[model samples]
Target: MKKLLLLLFSFALFGLWSERNVQSVHASTIASERLYRLYNPNSGEHFYTKARLEKQQLVALGWQDEGTGWYAPVTGEAVYRLYNPNAGDHHYTLSAGEKEALVAKGWRYEGVGWYSAPSNADYAKPLYRAYNPNALAGSHNYTLNKAEQTYLTSLGWQDEAIAWYGVNLPSPLIVDLSEWQSPSKIDYDTLANQIDGAIVRVYTGYRADNNYQRHLTELQKRGVPVAVYAYVAPSDTLAEINAQATQFYHLASSFQPKFYWLDVEDEYLSGGLTDGTSIRDAMESYRLTLATNGASKIGAYIANNRFATFNLDTTKFQAIWVPTYGDNSGYYENNAPDSTENFALHQYTSTARLKGYDGSLDLNRLSGQVSFAQLFS
Candidate 1:
C-alpha cells in the first residue's frame, strides 16, 4: 500500500511538470516574434527583421544569417527606423526627437522597425549598438549579445550604447504609394513593420510609375501584402479603356498583387464624358478585363463624394477604395471619409507625413467589416 501511494504521487508530480513545460513553450510561441539578423559582407551592414522570408532571401543573396538573434514580444513601445539616402546607411531609435532630427538632416524615416522592450521592465534585454565611423552604407550594428558588443568596441567600433530595446510586431494600417516616395533604394524592411498591407501605383495612365517594380519587389520580399492601381487617363473608346486594363494587368501580373484597381480621381475623364454612363462603361470594361486576366480581386479607387457620380455598379467589385482627405491637412485619423457611399478602404490623408519614407504618404484604413487577411488573401 505504501509503495502504491508513492507511485501515484510520482505520477502526479510528472503530470504537473509536463503541463508547466508545455504551457511555457506555448506562451513563448504565442507571445513573441523572432527578430532575424543578417550581415551583408559587401556593404558591411548588419540588418534585422521579424520577417523570416526576408532574412532567408537575403541569405540567398550572399547576406549571411550567422545563426541567432533575440525574440521580440507581441507588444511593446516603438523603435523608429531611418535610412540615410545620401549615405545609404540606416539608424534606429526610440526617441522621436532624434528621428525628427535625422529627418531634418535628410534621413528618410523607415517607420517603426520593431517594438522595444519596456525600459523600466526588469526582464528586458539590452540591445548594444556600435558605429563604424568609416563605413558609408552600414555604419551601425545592433545586437542583443553583450559579448559581441564588447568585441566590437575592442575593435574600435564606436559604442553607441543601447540604441533601443526590440520586443515585438504587428500590422494595422495601409498606405498607397507612388514614385512620389522615391522607391529605388528605400528601407522596405523597416517600413514593412509599420503597414499591414500596401496599395502601390503601378502606372499613371499609359506611363508606368518608375517606382512600382522596386516597391512591389521589396514589399513582397518583406512579406507585406501588395495591391496595384493605375491612374486612368481619358479614353477615346472602349478599346482604349480595355487596352489600359490589359496593359496594367500585364505589368502587374508577375507580382500577383492582392488587388487591381482603376484609380479614377481626376476631372480628365470628365470634360465630355458622362460619369453616369460613358465613364461607367469604361470603368466596367477595365474592371472586367482585369478580372478576366486572373486578378484575384478587383477594386475601384475614386475621389470622395464621386462614387455616386461614377454610376458604377458597386456590387460588381470586390472592394472600393476612396480617398477622402478632410482638408488635405496632411494628418491622419483627424477626420474620416465624408461620403457615406460604398467604400472598403478609406485613404484618409495624402499628407500623412509618416516616419518610414521621406515624402508625404497617403494613409488608409479598412472600412466597416474589412480586415487585412480578408483583403489581402
Candidate 2:
C-alpha cells in the first residue's frame, strides 16, 4: 500500500509541473502578440489583442498591423553647453543673463550638444545623440542656425555640422496660407516664381477651409507644387477620431496635393485629454487612418512649444513642419531647438510681407531633401 501511495504522489507532482509549463508558454505567446501593433485605418483605432481569433476578426474588418509602435523616449532636459579652452566647460541654465555672462567671459557657445552614446539594451536601435565637437566634460549644447553658426565662426570657434543630423545650410523659401489672408490681388505665377512650394490649410476640424479648392486651383494653374494640411482635434474616444479622419479624408482627397499634414495644436487634442501618451496614440490613429485610405504621403505640422509640451514622436511622420517666430518679423528667422530634428519645413515667420499680397503671410524654409518639383510629380 505504501509503495502504491508513493507512485501516485509522484504522478501528481509531474502533472502540476506540466500544467505550469503550459501556462508559461501561453503567457509568453500572448505577450509577443500584444507587442505586434495593429491599427484600423478605416476605423481610426488601435488594437493590441493577443488572441488569434480576435486578430483574424480585425483583419477581416480592414485592420492593418503597423508592426511595433514603440519608440525610444527622448528626454528634453539636456542643456546647451558652451566651452572655453581657458575658462572650462559651462552649461546654460535656461537663463539669458547666464548665457550673456558666459559670452562676456569669452566662452564659445557651441550649438545644441549631447553626450555621444552607443545603442543600449533599452534603445536597441542607435539613439540620436547630439553632436559635440569637443567631447568636453559638460552637458550637450543646443542647435544653431546659419546665422548663429556664422556668428560663432566669426569669433574663431570651430564649426562642424552635426554628424548624424544633416540640414540644408540655407532653407528653400516657401509660404503657407489659408482663408484668413485675402490673396485675390496675388498673382500665382509671381508667387511661384518667388517661392519653391506652397502649403495650405485644407481643413480646420470638421469644417473644410473656405478657400482650399480655390487656392489649389490657382497654384495648379501656375504650375506650382502644393501641399495641404488638416487641423486635428481628436476627442477622448476612438469613434470621435474616426469621424474627424473621415471628414478630413473626404475633403483633402479631392485636391490630391503633394503631401498631407495633420496640424495638431492649440488645445485640439489637449482640450479634453491630459495624458500625453493617449494623445500621441490618438494622433497616430488619425495618421494611420489617412495612410490606409489614400493619403499615404503624411506629415506633421506642430509648433515647438506644443511639440515639447505634448511630447510628440515626430519619427512616426514621414516629414515634420515646425513653426517658430523668433524674430516675429517679415523676414525668415529660425531658432529651432537642437534636441529634435531640424524639421523638413520651418515656418520662420507668420507675419512676412510679400510684394503680391497686402497682408502678412506665413513664410517657411524647406531643408534637406524636400524638393518642390518632385512633390508635384
Candidate 3:
C-alpha cells in the first residue's frame, strides 16, 4: 500500500511539471504572433510587421520597435505637381496663380497629387502637350502636359496633344571637380563606378584648371559622361566679359562638353555691383559671347539667396545650378531654394566624403527636365 501511494505522488508532480512546460511554450507562441512597429529615429522612417519574430529579426538588423501601433492610410487631396522636363524637379502647389506662373515658365502638370490614399491611386491624365524642337532623339524636352494650343502660339515649342512616349529617369549622381582635386589623387575607376557623370572646371577668368585636361582624359577613358564650368567675376564692361568668355570657350570647345556652366557666386555680386540692373546686363553679355563662340547648352551656377540680390534674369541661360548648403557645409533641405524651378541643378551638399578620396566634394542633383542622357545626347 505505501509503495503504491509514493508512486502516485511522483506521477502527480511530473504531470504538474509537464503542464507548466506546455503553458510556457503556448505563451511564447502567442507572443510571437503579436504585431509591432519599427522606427528608425535617425532617418525618420517607420515600418510595420505582424510577426513578433519578424520584428525581432529586423531589430537584429539595426531597427528598433517603437511600440505597438496601427497603420493609418493617408487620404490624398487633389493638388498639382508641376514637372519641368528641362530641369528634373517637381513643385507641389494648390494655388492657381502659382500653377499658371509655372506653366508660363514651361513646367508640365503630371495630372495627380502625390498623397492619394493607397487604396485609390490617382493617375495623371494628359490634358495638354509640350514639345521641344531642340531636344535630342530620346529626351524629355519632347513631352509636356495638358492642352496648350493657345499657350503654344506664344512659345517656341509645338503643342502636340499627345502623351509622352515613356519616362526615362536618369541616374542622379554627379560630381564637380576643380584644380583642387588632383588627377593623380583621383581613383577614376571607383568614381566612374559610383557616379553617372562629372562636371570639370575648365577655367577661372583667364587661368585654366591645371588638372582639367588630365581629369577629362581619365573620365573619357573610363567612359564617364562629362560637362564643363567656368568661374566668373563681376565685370562692368563688355570687354572684360568677352575676355572671360573667350578664355572659357578655347578650353571648353576642345572637349565639346555635354553642357557649359558659368560660376557666379555672391562674391562676384558683392564687389560693388549691388545694382540688380547692372548684374543682369553683365550676365547677358557673357551669355551672348558664349553663344557666339559655339558653346552649346550654357548654364549658370549661383547661390539661391543671391539670385534676388543680383536680380538675375534666370531665363537668359538654358539652365541654372544653385548651391544651398543646409548648414555651412551646404547639403541639406533647410538650405534649399525657395523656388524649385529657379534651378535645374541643385548642389545641395558640398561636404560629401567619397571613399579613396582625401577631401570633401560637391554633390549635385538634377532639378530640371534634363537628364544625364538627355544632356549628353
TM-scores for every predicted model: 0.55, 0.52, 0.52
lDDT of 1: 0.71
Estimate, for each residue in 129-203, the C-alpha lDDT of model 3 and write its tens digit: 445465432121212223344455366766655321111112356778988887667677655644567899988
Model 3, 345: alpha-carbon shift in Å? 0.7
Pairing residues by index, what is the TM-score of model 2?
0.52
Q: After superposition, which runs of candidate 2 have C-alpha atoms over 4 Å from their true positions?
A: 1-171, 234-236, 271-277, 369-377
RMSD of 1: 20.4
Q: For residues 53-110, could you state the per-residue lDDT of candidate 2 as single tens digits?
A: 5556867778785533221112222334465656344453334466668879888876
Model 3 error, position 41 (Å): 38
lDDT head-to-head 2 vs 3, winner: 3
Instruction: Output the worst ten-in-a-row residue range by lDDT, candidate 1.
Output: 23-32
**On a 0 to 100 scale, what is the lDDT of residue 169 in model 1?**
21
- Candidate 1, which segments miss by more than 4 Å at Cα? 1-171, 271-277, 327-330
User: How far does residue 219 in candidate 1 sit from its true spot (Å)?
Assistant: 0.8
By TM-score, the best candidate is 1
lDDT of 1 by residue, 18-51 (tens): 6876432211122334576788888888788777
